[model samples]
Target: MKRIAPAAERNKDPILEVLRPLLRDGATVLEIASGSGQHVIHFASVLPAVTFQPTDVDADARRSIEAYRAETGAKNILPSLALDAASDTWPVHSADAVVCINMIHISPWSCCEGLFRGAARILPAGGALFLYGPYRFFGVFTAPSNEAFDASLKAQNPAWGVRDTDQLLALAAETGFAHEETVPMPANNHCLVFRRL
Candidate 1:
């Protein structure tokens, strides 16, 4: 059965707008934590030349991705894979770019560390790693809503909360990536673009 994420539906277009200029023809994009498969399908439909490889840690999410792929018959979407960001080994060997949306804030810090490490291993020099989510910068929350959301996330799981941008930049640097730019989105969320160096 297909599942829908309202957040994914709402943010897809804005995310695509940021991705449009970065991604090139025939680029292989590996998406981490592809929750409902909504974003991948939408991106693939618009960017037919770029192949999207969607992965999720949960089986249900993978099923939803496959369902969306079947419904859309999108040729650029590869079969969804079961991938855990915290794992040292990844199923795919390489990609031109890696995209992770709404994941860092919800997972443990170790997962974020592993994400950078794995991305660095798979992406060649100059490869892009795009991250989208609400974030804190130098101990400041961008919005009151984000502050509240962070509190709620921690209340749910102590490990989960909005991450700090500076910390992520440091981690990226340690993992052979350079912080390129951060684009603010509609909500308090931001799109962080990094390049493998």
Candidate 2:
């Protein structure tokens, strides 16, 4: 069986552009909500020195990750693990960096809170948490498409909508992460990088 992440095709290169400079040689990165495992396998293929440990809560996704890893023969891509963003217990305790893409808006806001809390506990001082997704800023939507997307997401789940960058920063602050940089990407999405303070 085969699987794929819909956004991986469009966003991986852009995400990598931001990640390449930030990623240190031989650093361990824990990828959250690794749907289809496409990102992990693609990234690991390019960055053999950097170890990528992919995690997803879904069993089917885990199987897809394994399938991709096996097909790619990428050693730097570690076996996928089950990780629930809202759960107190995570599969791994520490990582040099954490990457999550397109998760916050699809799930309840508490998941973001939990993600930051877990990052606080696991990230060493100066370690980074990189989040990629569409977001609002200053109570304003960045794009009309984003506004429509937010409306659709809310229709699906009231608690799920594009988060405000300021709100997210505040939440990260509560979890001991200081804002580092905000990069603009294609499709009105933003890449927020925060360092453990």
Best candidate, TM-score-wise?
1
Tens digits of per-residue lDDT for model 1, 5-114: 88999999999999888899999999999999999999999999999999999999999999999999999999999999999999999999999999999999999999
Residue pairs clashing, model 1:
none
Per-model TM-score versus the true fold: 0.99, 0.98
Q: Which stretches of candidate 2 lie over 4 Å from their true place?
A: none
Error of 1 at 188 (Å): 0.9
State the local distance difference test value for candidate 2: 0.91
Error of 2 at 33 (Å): 0.3
Q: Give me candidate 2's TM-score against the actual structure.
A: 0.98
For residue 11, what is the lDDT in candidate 1?
95
